[model samples]
Target: MPNIQLIAPCLWFDDQAEEAAEFYTAIFSNSQIVNITRYGEAGHEMHGKPAGTVMTVAFELNGQPFIALNGGPAFKFNEAISFQVICQTQEEVDNYWEKLSAGGDKTAQQCGWLKDRYGVSWQIIPNILLEMLNDADTTKSQRTMTAMLQMKKIDISELLQASAE
Candidate 1:
């Protein structure tokens, strides 16, 4: 048997668990749908789902395991919790941002954070941004933060320039 991750995030969705899983798998390179469980006639009372309806979808994004559940609209994804994707280059950041935010909420995009079409929040951050923000020079760090706050998609070159100034 394949070794399973100790912990995995379970996403609650109204009825788009499979769709969301496919969307996410397409976005990440080393991703795939591991398994899918459907609702059976045994528990139609509590779940209110017909037999054979998709109840859960197990997937992996870049090797990180996640389970998407069709648990009705009782819960939603909010900014309080987010998955951060650290990119080594600007091209990587741009690629993820463009693909993840294709049909997402435009207004929610700020400081490299965006809400996807399925309402999941993602932070597309550059690796250098973290280093610059944690640098000993407060001026450089502050400048980088200020520059970052003013943009939706993170620009690594702009951050470098701001930090130098």
Candidate 2:
């Protein structure tokens, strides 16, 4: 048996597994497509995909393994499951937010959460946001939360100012 991690998230897509894998690998550093699996004659009736068509693309992002599966239209991604990207700097948050949200649904954006073109929800969050929200000072945290609720993409400086206030 091949060595595998304990858990790996599988992203279901309607025949866009390879495309999503490539897009994700390009966005994050130290990421790449690890393997590709294709459909075969077996189970053709149920799957309805042609033989040799991409069935799954195994990939990694920042060393976390994931699989993009061409699972057809029976299922879809929802905001209930989101990948939270904890960034240490404002630039990192902005970079990830811009790339992940491109060509995505604008109406889905709220409080640093966005649905990508592939319908995957991502939370581009600054690390300091958590610290501020968890602060012992209730007033500071409440103010920060209020400021965060009004914006789609989180601004670190604005959050800092809100907490100070």
Candidate models: Cα lDDT each = 0.96, 0.96
Tens-digit per-residue lDDT, 29-118, candidate 1: 899999999999997889999999999999999999999999998898999999999999999999999999999999999999999999
Poorly placed runs, candidate 1 (over 4 Å): 1-3
Clashes of 1: 0
Candidate 2's C-alpha runs over 4 A off are: 1-4
lDDT of 2: 0.96
> Which tens-of-lDDT digit does each residue in 86-137 have in candidate 2?
9999999999999999999999999999999999999999999999999999
- What TM-score would every model get versus the actual structure? 0.97, 0.97
The true-versus-predicted C-alpha distance at residue 155 of model 2, in Å, is 0.2
